[model samples]
Target: MSTPTVVLVHGAFADASSFRALIPELLADGIPVVAPAVPNRSLNGDAAYIASVVRQIEGDVVLVGHSYGGAVITVAGVEDNVRALVYLAGYALQEGESLGELQGGFPDSALATALVQTTYPLPDGSTGTDVSVDPTKVHDVFAQDVDPEITKVLAVSQRPLAAAAFGEPASAAAWKTKPSWGVVSSSDNTINPDVERHGYQRAGAKIVEIDSSHLVMLSHPKESADVVREAIRATDR
Candidate 1:
């Protein structure tokens, strides 16, 4: 096997730019990286979009997902060419499990109080819910380790996720069949750290813990990149 290309998937409240810092680091290590902008409107739709992106890549892929993106890749990473899956403070959900269900057992996330919900028209002409973290709480709950200045900008530009995305049950669990790795953000307030550990442990992933917030890729890009590289090496063998 040869070095696999990396396809990064960002979770709710974020876009492809969320992986900006980690991309260059992966590229520096000679790994090709692609961070596709996830629509985040629906779980199956997002996974299908990512699967299409994976199909366009030239070789095997190491699919990496953050936050809700973990659920996206858990569905998309089952693509034939995907050799590994890496979850960064991400949800590694089981088949038929929804993010909402998995989160039910965890301690209340700070994001609950910080979220702002708005109604929007869906393609079907029905009203849908879109959720985003309150700007004032973005830095504290989502990216505490990052500099407040940058987080301030992130808060304003943050993408909103459709509330339905969380309730959508995952149709696949890629970790069940693929090699897996995980980065547990020890200080994560958005997703309880214990929840992350349980997800990884259940998947039997090689786990690495970092003393960072939910935005580990931003707060600790080097470490995040290193973990991706480790997955590449493990799969390339």
Candidate 2:
């Protein structure tokens, strides 16, 4: 059989660069990978954008999303070249569910307050703000397994999600029909592990628990990639 293509979707507060560490490993194994930059400000536009990318792909694809990107690909990538999905410390939404509703499902945590920022309106009627995480907190909240220098860069490089994106509901739940795989960051503070567990339950996705933080792909790239490869292999059987 030909190699499976992997289209990665990053979560809120991040872009396609979030998959930097994992893509190389997967590519080395002869698996093609694509991670489009998501428009963190416009959820609907972002989903439509990603959907276009999925539609352009040439072969059987495994759609992977991290955090809010999980929700985006669910709505955009469901009926494309995508044959399976991998949620890497990501969200899973059912039909009619929005990211904002999922956020409200659990009580606030340290990460919730950390996400707040001052928003300024733009000439285009959109808004913008800074998304900088404290360097020290990066290790505790994200990839603890990776190099300290990596988190140092990540702390400064974090992207902020637009307030409007969270309110966009899922166009449809991809998990309901697609075979899915989920990687849980047991120590994640950003998206409550409780919330992640809830997503896993809702999707009925095959589960793999990693004792890491929110950025499991960066912290545990090999393991993260392994589970994803396994997910693709499962489809071949």
Candidate 3:
């Protein structure tokens, strides 16, 4: 079989740039990688956008998501040419599950205290709430392992997710049908590590654990890339 293209979807409070470190590693190994910018809006919209990107690819696709991006791919991975799913410290929610619902059962995330919410006017003339992690708390809550300078920049440039996004339940769970792999950030504070393990376990994904923060791809890019490489290799068989 031909090799699959790796489509990366980043989670909340982050943009495609989060995959910068991991991209080159994948490229060095001759793997094609594309990190789509998730809208951080509603799950359905984000999933649809990701699915659209997957459709644009000419060959098979291995869809990978981190954090909330996991939820996006879970709904998007059902695309015909998507051959696999990879979650990096991401949510692999089941049908009818929402990120908020899943996190409710787990220990409270440090992110809860670190978040700041603001109201913004939507194009539809409705008001929407946007959530951003406090820049002062970014290092402790999201990127403890990343360089202090980079974390500062990440804080300022971080994307804010729509407050409604967390409440939106996943309409479909592609993980149930697709082969999946997961990377658990052992020291993740933003999302409980146990919750991550449970999601991966339920999805029956091949799993790897890395000692890093929620931004595992940034802090431990090589290890993160290794898991993505493994997923691509598995699908090639």
Candidate 4:
């Protein structure tokens, strides 16, 4: 049998490039990986766009989502090829759920306040949201475990998601049917560990916890990858 294909969907404020480093390692292990860059962070558009990519890859598939992308995959995982779903410190929005409402249960964190963006006039003089982070503080908040060079690159490469995606709701949650896997970052300050546990429990997914930050894949790639492989193996049994 051919190796199973993996589709990686990145979260808000990030594009497909977020998986650039992780993909190479997985590919080296003979896993076929595809990371589709979603346009402007619209989950609705993202799900539709990623589903298109999912249709093109052959064999059974494992859909992986990080942060907000988890919610995207949950909505998109209903596609025929998706055999398993993996959530990496990611959101798992349930049926008819929206991030706005879901976030209510979780206490606000420093990451929330740090996201305040300034609107500026674009080339056409139309005002648009231009998001930025306190570069000095990004390492501690986003990619502390990643190589300093990589963390700097990611800080500069991060994109500003349109405000609309946060309010977008999931119509159908695929995790209800597909077997799931979840990774919880115990030290995550952006996404509360308590909230992550709630999501993992709700999905009834096989769970793994790590004493890492929000970016667990970058912080603990080998372990994160191994957990993902286990999810793929679970589908075999």
Stretches of candidate 4 off by over 4 Å are: 118-132
Residue lDDT tens for model 4, 13-99:
667777776787798889888888866546677788888889888778999999888888988899988999999998888888887
Scored against the true structure, residue 201 in model 1 reaches a CA lDDT of: 96
Question: Ten residues in a row with the worst lDDT in model 3?
Answer: 228-237
- TM-score of model 2 vs. true structure: 0.91
Q: In order, what is each prediction's RMSD in angstroms?
A: 1.0, 2.1, 1.0, 2.5
Deviation of model 2 at 97, angstroms: 0.9
Q: Please provide, for model 1 over 1-237, each residue's C-alpha lDDT reduced to its tens digit, 9 standing for 90 to 100.
A: 488889999999998888988999998878888888999899989999999999999889999999999999999989999999999999999999999889898778888899999999978998999999999999999999898998999999988999988899999999999999999999999999888899899999999999999999998999999999899888885
- Report every candidate's CA lDDT: 0.93, 0.80, 0.92, 0.81
For model 2, how does the per-residue alpha-carbon lDDT over 73-113 read when each residue is reduced to its tens digit?
A: 77775765778888988878878888879879887645755
Error of 4 at 56 (Å): 1.5
Best-fitting candidate, scored by lDDT:
1
What TM-score fits each model?
Answer: 0.98, 0.91, 0.98, 0.91
User: In model 2, which runs have C-alpha deviations exceeding 4 angstroms?
Assistant: 120-136
| Backbone N/Cα/C clashes per model | 0, 1, 0, 0
